[model samples]
Target: MAADGLDEIDYGILHLLQQNARSTTPVDMAEQLPVTDTTIRNRIDRLEEEGVIEGYVPIVNYEKAGFPIRLQFSCTAPTKKRHQVAGQALELPHVVKVDEMLSARENVQVLAVAKTTEEVNEITAGLDDLPLTIERESLLREERRRPFGHFGQHVVDD
Candidate 1:
């Protein structure tokens, strides 16, 4: 394991889980990795205890689910209020993710889904009510999407 407690095997397990969290069992992982089922289970348990593997979630295709419009908003707020503003954004409906950015121009990023332009405007209006200045807004046009693979690759290389 590295100084932070996660080693190459741990990363590989994480990657396999990320690719298919619901059905990828430790036994299945052991077949592909150089570890036994008991080792896989032990590593996963340790990783969970260390909070490296927070939780499992299903990846949803919002566009296919009728939420076609993807709105991205970048807001600027004081460093002290960044977390507060991000929290407020998280409470907004349809918000998928809210992050605090460290850059000067933009300090908060909000990603939300909407079914129509009016819904997008409504979401924007709500964000405007927060104690932050909206710096930029864009409608995302996703051209490609895939599962995360870098973590597994890094582990193998290490």
Candidate 2:
């Protein structure tokens, strides 16, 4: 095993997959790492089976997909009911993401997308009905993500 119980090949696979899962194939990873395509395939399967890879999902452009209004809701949930409140918030139709924070003041954060201000108002109303207190709500301009750098570059035999 490599650092953090994952082998170097695993890290390489994770790095490449994070960079571009759609374009990065086992063969591509093999050419970069000191392993065969079969090895890469098997490793990916194992990683998924072990619940590390989780799931492969497309990063959709909500605005382009007819949801131009993006909003973030910051809320304070009762400490003991944070998880429950988050789950309830996530169940709301426009809600796309819910995060439970460590801070008690603003513990629940919800990301929602809508096609119109009416829909945005509806989402806000739904959240307000929940067991949490809405602290702040703001429009989301954009979001960017990238592979974790600690996953590192391609592994080479030293």
TM-score of each predicted structure versus truth: 0.87, 0.93
For model 1, what is the C-alpha lDDT against the true structure? 0.85
lDDT minimum window of 10 residues, candidate 2: 149-158
Kindly list the per-residue Cα lDDT of model 1 for residues 90-115, writing each as its tens digit: 99988998988887669899989999
Task: Write one digit per residue (lDDT tens) for candidate 2, span 33-100.
Answer: 88899999999999999999999999999999999999999999999999999999999999999999
**How does each model score on lDDT?**
0.85, 0.89
Backbone clash pairs for candidate 1 read none
Local error of candidate 2 at residue 32 (angstroms): 0.7
The ten-residue window of minimal lDDT in model 1 covers: 149-158
Best by lDDT: 2
Clashing pairs in 2: none
Model 2's TM-score against the true structure: 0.93
